[model samples]
Target: MVSEMSKKREFKDDEELEHGKVVKRFNGLPQFNLQRFCYRHNPDVQSSVGSTTCYKQDANRLKSVNDKISQLPKNEREEVHHVVSTFRKSNDKLRKLMLEGILTACCFPQLSYVASEVQNMIRIDFISILPQEISLRILCYLDCQSLCSAAKVCRRWKTMADDDRVWHRMCEQHIDRKCPNCGWGLPRLHMKRARNPTPTRCTELITPWKAIYRDRFKVECNWRKGQCVIQEFKGHMDGVLTLQFSSRLLFTGSYDSTVAIWDLCSGRLIRRLSGHGDGVKTLYFDEQKVITGSLDKAIRVWNYITGECISTYRGHTDSVLSVDSYKKIIVSGSADKTVKVWHVESRTCYSLRGHTEWVNCVKLHPLSFLCFSCSDDTTIRMWDIRTNACRRVFRGHVGQVQKVIPLTIIDIENLVVDDKQTSDPPTDDPHDPLTEDLPYPTHILSCSLDNTIKLWDVKTGNCVRTQFGHVEGVWDIAADNFRIVSGSHDGTVKLWDLQSGKCIHTFQGKSLQEPHDQQAETAPHKVSPIACVGIGDSEFFTGDEMGYVKRYRFDTT
Candidate 1:
């Protein structure tokens, strides 16, 4: 057998070649024994040799270390080579201490600080040692994901990995598990539903989005008078494109990956219903069902009471933009350049195809069983439900209409009752008031990518009022007979007086201009998408691209 000293020297030479350097000793210090230093230690060898075995084992250990050094990456190989070469030049006492430190780290495999301290002790003379159990306890406090990665490196770590309580402790640190009996202490076993009660994916840093909330946004004075106060809801993963409201609830459809429901009174999230593989573009709801049209090319009907999805209707090959429900018919608009009608009860499908571009919005004419759909094709078509044919194509908006606001003839008659009741309102009865007739101005109000909101006389195919003030494209519009509320990419909620063709008030929810990708010729900053809006007569909710919803009150009086 080769002498241990010669073997160590030969292995070291091979390591130097692998690392692109040669070892040079000037101060007669010893080098590290790599195998014992990083992998494991043998205390029995030190006992068997008694005294001289320290030197004999050190020689054999240094050979094994030189072999391990050859396996490291070229940069790391160079670093280890430089460290060993430079340390060998140091004095004998320092050399012996370095070898002993590396040996001590190998012997006490349970201690992480021993290795860390040895690395530190290599540079300094008198390093202090903390108790091994205390250091192990500290290591247990690290995150589960990080601990698991470290455990894969060696056998000693593999033994420590057997402790099940370590994972539970990590879970306790990261997640808030609901427990009825235990309050902020070691939780008691209790029945409660909480989200993601386990440590899963590693915690990644979230990039900061532009600040949307600021002090300058004054709450509209009219909100104080109402019993219900509105709050901004933000948790969706993407941009919201549509909104709908029921008696006590609000529904939002988003380009973000899911559809969300919120309690209007308490502003608490009810649940996020996820089955849509893509962004939800439109939302509609009734007493029994809530429907969402998604870019996933499918429409889903969810049971409103049970919060369970009843059926998924799929036929469109491209993004579904809008869905509207009538008595038994569910009309859907899609970018595939077609409109589909599904019988709500029976689920029979009928398709209407005439638009050249993507259809953006669809609605049923209230008095008649007629259906109207607007498209990026720059035309709105009125379809005859009975014939399944296009009755008339209303050409008005210069760009794609984002929403078709249907004003039914029946709603106008109801408005007449509301006008009469409100006008002569001094009766002892709380329900009864004045009754008068007001002329129905327009049957439909349509907003478009053209930066205008047009009122259309659906029966006559005439444009009534083209209200303009939004500097950017209008994504969604809501209205009564007197006023129209629009949400624009310019980040403002604007109220327009339909009769006077004037903007009543602007709620600057997002008051700052953001930088554009490419500078505009005139305006440097590009406007963001307001995305969606929902409103009652007095209060309106506007959603932005960053999943923020701002509640505003319109100064209607």
Candidate 2:
């Protein structure tokens, strides 16, 4: 249908390109405004001769041309003048031809002279010439460090680089998620969603976008550098089992069979809710209420502020080890080796049985109507809550699996996977195959009594990565977009870079901020296992068997 000449198009030296004609036609040429060169913006700099702040060198340039023309012999000068007049009168192509001929006739020295003169005459400042919107778009391509450096370049650059428009995009790119381009992550949504209502809280909601970025960036740096001042909350009498904190409150469940609420900032106990007949094994909370599972074979919801037992649900035949809720739906794991899905509105319960041993943990991902459970059977199962059926099984741990969490890893740097042949094939499913409209987590994080933490591929049921550092069993792990905080029975709390699957820092103590006073009632507990860990933007909290909760805060310093 097409001729060879038509398909194999030819281009002329003087012809302009399509789509990007303007940029290609004059790219690398000195920038100009009207007829004068933009000296400050133009990279083709020259010695100024009575030039103003505008940086024009037109006076010296015209003088140099005139002096050269006048130095030639009279007849030669007249001939050159005639040729120049004709060249000025001819078309662009003809002028180019004349210049080509002149350059071809020049010897090495003359050509070197020409090259030296033209070298600095072709430079351009492309960004300076672009419009504001286009220039901001270009700046958006730069990473945080590069943008900061660009802001230091000049007043104009600072103005544009510090603009809220640019930083807002930066916030969206990094905050609560990792930037796929830079692989740099900021704070997670948990940090932003937790609003401290105390008057001591800063006006972060009204803060400038750049200020927000700077603060979160500092927090991330502190986390990576292991720079933090830890504060201790010590009031629980028995071994602390589960703990979680928000912006202003810290809730801890303990072996004392009581759930204690404390002011997160001051580390002072607010109240204690006692309803469970035995040791509290797990606790989770949102805005309105707190939920806890206990070894008494009961799950209860409480109004933490009023210390009231709002309701109690009993279904598991054995001790309830873990519990999580989203609205009216609650999921719990028990020593009975089964998981129960409780529908509060319908007042009905469904039991999911698969594990051969005790189920240590259960986490509900309500968005996808999914649940994850780990057991003493050394395996984890993902269940479709809607159908009350097991969707997938993850088996790699040699010891009992203690905890499991579903995660949507935006940028997994080095996926930790088991090399051993698994019963299920390694597969990637970005979308849920069972439900076309819903999405599911790509990976899961689990810790075991085997003394390791593993990253699992959800679809393939393969252990993609394993993090090994704890000398004892890993009890719990909490993660955000950037980092994972794990507590171990080795009496240590370790922070891991979630992307790299590497341990960044480890706290090796009874989990104390500093040495206790000489007059204290008791010495710090040694080898007291950290039973639970919680993380935020600028801080992480670890609760140990010593009945102590240590808040490692990076923002303080």
Candidate 3:
């Protein structure tokens, strides 16, 4: 309720004086007054801190003020209250004048008392008072650890810190790409619904973005610390050669001329797919079908669901070395010294023939409509699938190129590599961004019989970085946004940081033990080469020459 004096007094509406013709409201701030309270201590606003206990300094100030007031006579206390109430209702200029007059009348000891009290009272809860938009903008600048700490401050803080919009920005910084500030990148979640951070209307129920970020962050930490449990799968009669996996199952191809599918959760054989006439050398699969290439010189498509061979494609006269596909387009590399792109629906086959020696790897990058092939000829070629013409040739490897993986490396030029010829990788800043606007892949990772893994700049066709860890040849390698997993002829598996090009962890070869055996064997088993490798969201699989596959699971939960 307004006092009668306030009701009678006329005050001017807030407006800015025009030095020019146009006039405007004084500011965008809400209309307010100093009587009941204002910016300093508004009755309408909640207490700054949410906890039940008062802050120590605030409690001390309150105790001292109450002590002084209680000591005064009843009549003097009423006079003091009137003076304080008048000061609270005064405008800024009047209050400052009143403060100066009070200070002038005080002696040194009194001035010292006022100074100490003012110091304790000056601090404010700015994040709580600022408009939410400005508050969130301030929070956005904080890193993950700092942001998480802020969430524990209070209920209001937790709501703002765990906001979907804030977590969405966090995901955008670290998902499928390295964050420039922290040098950390998280694996992209396979589920499109959760990973796709699309904006929603205010009325719509938003996804739990902070939870998604937390789970992925845990997996990334496991990868970095090399914390994992190893599970071995054994059944093939000959050397295990290639493997791939989904969220729930693991697939392996072997020199036994068969493909094996195992339940990843149960660690049991789900199916034994037997159709290839010779050793299965390479394979790729999705939810619908499994495509395998064999030393028998044929590419076979199987309906793994029913354990049936849906189709057989025989065109290469020599052993099929590698295979990859997208849509109806199947690309195959062979000892016939060629890479074949088969459009199954159109019944058309286009041959890419620049490689002089056996083509060892074929990779299809569907997004750019391009195919990458590395060969024993010591060259990696990027081909335009639409034209069947080799767009560029990368020539640097001294030995056969065993694998080629097209990649989108963030800040590819920053990594240090050892290529023997150049003792150091270039630390020069990246070239123009427009030069990187090409539809083709940004970089390529290739391992060779040369016993080294190389990172290449796709646009410049130059080997930018080389990783050397395996004492023998790096036969096969797999990579994701965060790290690289390589299986080598040295009878070891190595994990690498893709960003830094540094070897992080290495596992020595170990033989599988019989699960049914009652007595454990004390004898040491023979070590064999790791011929193939596959990587998933929180795990990686290595298939060795002894017909054994090991799954390294990194997720703690």
- Tens digits of lDDT, candidate 2, 1-557: 23444346555653444443322333323233325444542333322111323343455666778799999999989997899789868886998999899999999999999999888766534455565678889998899999989987666677778888898889889887778888777775344433345534465433377777877888777877999998988888988999988889998999999998998866788899998899999988999999999999999999988888999998899999999999989899999999999999999999999999999999988778889999999999999999999988888899999999999875554444445634555556565444546677878899999999998877677787888999999999998767899999888888888877788998964734335656344764555789999888889898888798888999877
For each candidate, C-alpha RMSD in Å? 25.1, 10.6, 7.8
* TM-score winner between candidates 1 and 3: 3
Model 3: lDDT to the true structure: 0.82
How well does model 2 score by local distance difference test? Answer: 0.81
lDDT of 3 by residue, 1-557 (tens): 24444456554564433342223342222222224445445422334444223422235556788799989999999999899889968988999999999999999999999999789667655566666777788888788999989988887777788788898899888888888888788877673444445546732433478767877888888888889898999989999999999988788999999999999889999899998889999999999999999999999999999999999999999999999999899999999999999999999998889999999999998878789999999899988888898878888888899999999866655666555535444434364222434576788999998999998876666687888888888889999877899998888999998877889999887645465654546655436889999888788999998898998888764
Looking at model 2, the pairs that clash are 416-464, 416-465, 417-463, 417-464, 417-465, 418-463
- Per-residue lDDT of model 1, residues 1-557, tens digit only: 23444445564323443234444521111223323432122232232223224433355657789899999999999999998887868776898888777666674554665667567434411000223344346546654445657567454444344344454444344222212222111111121222334534531111111000000011122333332344688878777677887547888878775778898777888888888888999888988889999999999999866778998999998999999987678999999999998986775899999999999999875346678898898888887676788866667788878888776433232222222223432324332211213232246778898998876655456565677789888888886534567988777778775444468777665433544523344554444568787766446778888777766533333
Best by TM-score: 3
Residue-pair clashes per candidate: 8, 6, 0
Give lDDT: candidate 2, residue 195: 32
- Cα deviation of 470, candidate 3, in Å: 1.4
What's the TM-score of every candidate structure? Answer: 0.51, 0.78, 0.79
